[model samples]
Target: MSIDQHGDHVLQGMSIRKLPKVSLHDHLDGGVRPATIVELADQVGLEVPEDTADDLADWIAERSDSGSLVEYLKTFDLTVGVMQTREGLTRVAREFVEDLAADGVIYGEVRWAPEQHLSGGLSLEEVVEAVQDGIEEGEDAAEQAGHDIRVGQLITAMRHTDRSLEIARLAVEWRERGAVGFDIAGPEDGFLPSRHREAFDYLASEFFPVTVHAGEAAGLDSIRSALLDGRALRLGHGVRIAEDLDVVSRAGDEVLVQFGDLARWVRDREIPLELSPSSNLQTGAISAWGEELADHPFDLLYQLGFSVTVNVDNRTMSRTSLTRELALLAETFEYDLDDLEVFQLNAAAGAFLPVEEREELIELIGEGFER
Candidate 1:
């Protein structure tokens, strides 16, 4: 049951890394390899805080562990700095998929803000194409290595920015090519999904899928806006939805609770909550409850019949993987293999893929767990 340096472990005599998993909340800019950053930065003549890859990893880890969203976001400046050009974007996207495959992720949605990558004179279309090219190359490489993996782009728009409508159009334009869904990331406190009403309306008209970043830095109001305005099929780190629950009584193995209308509807509808244990702790998303992983309302949400899916919101910054997130949860909550498998199934069901494809992913997970 001991985890290795790579955040992999054996559970019940099975390698956790070998289990089939789905990644729905992974971010492209957040998962850049430190070595790739160094090389790309050198090519672009961009200065980096750390020269060597190992030191650079340590540097990112320290900066992200600051427990402030603003401080954690600063680390992205370096990664985004190197990703402005087409080649840089392509290489990083390719490596992103490769890393996901190595971590045993069978399906992944790589979310990145296309507007951020267009700062180097590239058009939004060009940025999406570059990332698609990289993703295809990475898929080919994984197939050649005897591992099967597939990834899709979750075209994201910065919440504080005003280009969401443009980003939404870009996402729909590339829907047939590689873009699977749309998202609004960046700061969440002052910004609400309602700010992008036009974009969400456009997406809804086109029947495009969306997942909003809400209930993380914000609260129930944000989640409400995401579902009502953004038409979000899933919630990004919707951990704060726990605030709507009132623990009336607690017994040894049973607890009585009352849920607000929003919480009840979300749970009844089974809107998936992309919960990242480590990132929530680091970003203080779950601070209202406590400062520890066990204090996270993940177990409560799961027990309360919510569609709770575990994720690595940012692998590089958080220094985690899907396997590691699952392992950590298992240790904290004394979860077994069945619990891990249920999380994977939830993610698969909530993926932006077609229903048939999602069913296939579920079958894969079932087989993997059975093995």
Candidate 2:
């Protein structure tokens, strides 16, 4: 099985890109097309590092591959800078959904922080509405193109900011208007989910779905805070939870392991880990394991009974898609079509959609894979 230039591989005589998939950890700003960024930046009179879209994409990718989350996050400045207006936000959101559909995503949840896009004088509600408009348009366009896709918004707040409570309110207010969930992204080391307990408490009171960025840049303590304080239904790149696992021994397809309480609870409860292979490597989230895709603890966590899901945390930064991430994992771990299907199933189950909707997505995935 050989992967093509687009990171597509044929397994069992089927192209990975044609398989139905679910995306739960995708970021809206992080997935913007470089061409769109260049065009939007020009309209807004913002200076970009590169003039052409291809060169700009290469610039962003090279800078983002710095292997440090802080430095990697700095790349967002350009994306967010261009997305401060209604038109910019809507266009980006629309293109994001369209890209997901083209990649064979049947269902996706797009996460982006509203606070970061308010610099253009748009209100919080306005930005959410803008993105919603784009999502609807993208969905319609994809349907016209014979690719049925649905995307929901995960209204996110920057972890280092004090707007969590406000953003929680914004997300809940727009719950019926395409907002599906809430999240806290940005730096994770210094800002624990506990810092936003008030916001989490409000969300819990309102019964809003929440996912926290934890166990990536930090370790078990961050994961604990996310579960205990943020009431996270899913963990964003919770790869570092592997730190709690003590690998006693290893053999071909069999390994002895000692699990700490945190690891045991997370595994036993089957908390979904949004593992982004290429993004995890670029951001140094899985540095403890190694510097390559093969070093990811994804196989270990999967074998240990953890609900592991594949994702493209940032498509532009990582230069990946769900198809590519799955293909890379299959190539690295020798996974078969069945394994790829399981990852999609995990994502469907962990999606911020209603149970019936999730079940429907699972059925769609099954049928697609069967075909």
User: How accurate locally is residue 359 in candidate 2, as Cα lDDT from 0 to 100?
Assistant: 97
Candidate 2 regions with alpha-carbon error over 4 angstroms: 1-7
Residue-wise C-alpha lDDT for candidate 2, range 238-263, written one tens digit per residue: 99999999999989778999999988
Error of 2 at 206 (Å): 0.7
On residues 1-371, what C-alpha lDDT tens digit does candidate 1 reach at each position? Answer: 45532667778888889999999999999999999999999998999999999999999999998777778888999999999999999999999999999999999999999899878899999999999999999999999999999999999999999999999999999999999999999999989999999999999999999999999989999999999999999999999999999999999969899999999999999999999999999988888998988899999999999999999999889989888988988888988999999999999999999999999999999999999
CA RMSD, predictions in order: 1.1, 1.2
> Which runs of model 1 end up more than 4 angstroms from their true locations?
1-5
Please state the error at residue 272 of candidate 1 in Å.
Answer: 0.4
lDDT of 1: 0.94
- The local distance difference test score of each candidate is 0.94, 0.93
Error of 2 at 320 (Å): 0.9
TM-score of 2: 0.98
